[model samples]
Target: MLTVMRHELNMQDRSFSTYLFGFFLLETIGIAAMIYNINNKMANFEYCLSTITLVFVLIIPLITMKSIAEERKLRTDQLLYSLPLSMWDIVLGKFFATLVNFMFPMVFIAVYPLLFKRYGNVYLLTSYGSIIAFIFLGAALIAIGMFVSSLTENQGIAAGISAVIIALNYYSLDLANITSSTKQGSLLVILFFILIIGFIVRSLTKSTLAGVILAALLAAITGIVYLIKSDLFEGLVPSVMSKISFFQRFYAFVNGNFDVTAIVYYVSMTAFFLFLCVQSLEKRRYN
Candidate 1:
């Protein structure tokens, strides 16, 4: 695992993606700093953190796009399978390596609070809390990005897919608002989401029977429940979307609440996606 981490870091040093990510980070932080300190004349660093978090949708794909996709593209994944290391080790090694690369700029961003403290009236608790939440959010997204990368051999496709997923997540709140709150509407949307999940299951397992069975079972259950108590489906889609959105949870931190539930949610998301990444690699080995 350490060897993989070291190799990934070394490769990143020679790659343009690392520098591109750095540039994005610099630009995001720079603009946030200008707005908070100059234009807004506010000492709240949490505002800056909130503003820059959206930029992750654009830049995080660059770091994770090549993590596993490049290995498959270059046909090195077979060598990895032959190694004694488990799939989890390889996945985590790559994940931590990408995390380290992402954290390079964050180390500097962490100092912003202290720097602002020197000026006046920086809400240190909320500021630092938001920073921590921001890091966790990025880590969670990176795990999802890594899983997306593992699904394809082409880096560009991985990045594009990841960007779309992250962008949708960033806007999940607005998307949820646009969704209908009616029981029938929510039921239809839930059925659609189940179909999407079925497709994902099929892709991951490469088993049409398994995917079809799972989807049919879930759809049947949803239909039964909806028929029994239509009220239960009322506003279900929007509520679920609001609950699961990563950005929505981060707003709690920005609002000066050190929400433990949000932290747990982010950690759970990170672990779940990393597990998916391991499974994706294992599937490759079997194939």
Candidate 2:
């Protein structure tokens, strides 16, 4: 795993991908920080971090587009398949390789809070908390992107799909607001969500029967609850969506609360997606 990680990182650097990613990330964050802090004289560094996170909608796909997708496309996956390492090792190595690339720009970002503290009184707790959230968010998003990459050999397709999913995660709050708030509406939306989950399972596992069973069970339980207590479903979609909003959690830290739950949520999300990514790759090996 360590060897694979080093090789991946070395390849990324040699390809100029790392430099390009770091350059854009630094430039965008620098511009945002300058505008919000230097020009507007904003006291909180958290706002700058919050604003810069928007770049993930683009940067994540860029970073992960070729992680596994390119390997499959170039038939290098056969090399991976023949290697002595387990699927979990390969998946973890690739994940860390992508994460290391992601972390490089953050090293520069880490200095901003200190710079602000030098200038005047800065809320180090909130500033640091927001930064932590920002990195955690990136870690989770990269894991998602890696999963997307595993689904397709085409880098462009992987990138496009990742961009759309990340964009939805970023804007899910607004989408939830626009969706219906009635009990039936929430139940229907939840059913749709379950179907989507089942579809992903089917896609990864190539097992229609299992997917159908999972979807049917989820829909049945949801329907039973909705029928029993229709009023309980009211506004449930928005509540659930709000809870699922990735950006909103970071905002909590920006508001000066170091939310332990938010940190756990981010870490859980990262682990979940990475697990899925590994499974997706393992499926290919077995097939």
Candidate 3:
């Protein structure tokens, strides 16, 4: 694990994309600080983070696109399997290396609250809390991006898919708000997501029977439940979307609330996706 971490970090140090990712994040923070802190005379640095959340859509892919995709492209994943390391070690090493690289700019961003404190009232507690949660959110997304990378050999495809997923997650709450509150609408939405999950389960495990049975079982249960109590599904889709959205969780910190639940949610997401990543690699290892 240490060897993989060191190698990954060394590679990042020499990679142009690594520098570019830092440059872009730092630049976005600078601009956001200027707008929210200077022009608007806002004391809350968290506002800057809120405004710049969209940057992750691009940055997530920027770093994660090539993580596993490039390894597979060059057939280096086989080399990794032969190493005296478990899949957990390799996945965690890559994840921590990329996360450390991300934290480089965050170190500067952390100083912003202190710098602003000199000028006037800055809510350091909430400000720092938001920053911490932001890093957790980034950690979760980085894990997700790596899983996406593990699914493909082409960096561009991985990057594109990651960007789309980030964009959707970033706007999930907003999208949910606009979606129908009707039971029928909610049912449709639930069924749609179930179908997508079914396809995903099939692709990832390479088990059509497993996916089909799981999907069918869930659908049948949903149908029976709906028939018995249709009112239970009223606005269910929007509620689930709001609950599951990563960006929605971040808003609690922005609102001066140090939400422990959100932090736990982010950590859970990171772990779940990292587990999937290990499984993805395990599939290829045996093949």
Candidate 4:
């Protein structure tokens, strides 16, 4: 795993995209700092961080687009399979390598709170807390992008797919507000989500029966709850969207609240997606 990680990092070091990712990230933050800290004369560094949260949707896909795609394009994944490492090891190594690339820009970002502290009464503790959550949000999204990259051999497709998903997540709060809040609407939407989950499970396992069973089980449970307490279903869709959105959870930190559940949510999301990434490779190995 370490060998794979080092090799991946070395390869990224040579890629122009890697440098661009750093440059773009820093420039975006710099611009945000100017707007929030300089122009507005706000002492809250977290506001600057919050302003640039959407930047992840752009750069994350850029960095993770080629993670697994290039391997298959060059026919090198076969070499990975034939190697002694397990699927988990290979997936983890790639994830960590990309995570390191993500963090290179973040190290510079970490210094902003200190820089701002010199000028005024900056909320350093809140700023650091938000930064930590921001890192978790990036990790979870990187894992998601890596999984997306594993699905296609084209870097552009991987980037496109991941970017769309991230954009949806970034705008999820507004989407939730516009969505139907009625019990019936929530029930249908939740069922739709269950169906999507079923398809994802099918893709990962390559077993239609397993997917159907899982979907049916979840739908049945949800249906039973809806029937027993219809009020519980009211406004559930927005609540679900709010809970599921990566950016929505990040707002708790931006609002100066250190939410432990949000931290756990981000960690769980990262681990879940990494597990799926391993499963993606395992399916290819079997086929």
Off by over 4 Å in 4: 197-218
Task: Give the C-alpha miss distance for residue 238 in model 1, angstroms.
Answer: 0.6
Q: Residues 129-248, candidate 3: write the lDDT tens digits.
A: 999999999999999999999999999999999999999998888988999999999888878878988998898778999899988988998899999999999999888888889998
Model 2 TM-score (2 dp): 0.93
Best candidate, lDDT: 3
Whole-model lDDT, candidate 3?
A: 0.93
Cα lDDT of all candidates, in order?
0.90, 0.88, 0.93, 0.91
**lDDT string, candidate 1, 165-275, tens digits:** 999999888999999999989988889989999998898788999999999999999999988999998898899988889998998999999999999999999999999
Per-residue lDDT for 1-287 in model 4, tens only? 99899999999999988899899889999999999898999989888778888988899998899999999999999999898999888888998999999888889999999998998999888999999988999999999999999999999999999999999999988999999999999999989999999998898789999999999999999999998999998998898887789998898999999999999998999999999888878888677
Question: For residues 153-222, what per-residue lDDT tens digits would candidate 2 score against the true structure?
Answer: 9999999999999889899899888989998788888999999989987976799998999999999998
Root-mean-square deviation per candidate: 1.6, 1.9, 1.6, 1.9
- If both were scored by TM-score, which would come out higher, candidate 2 or candidate 3? 3
Candidate 3 residue runs with Cα over 4 Å from true position: 201-210
Clashing pairs in 1: none
Error of 1 at 52 (Å): 1.8
TM-scores of the candidates are 0.95, 0.93, 0.95, 0.93
Candidate 3 clash pair list: none
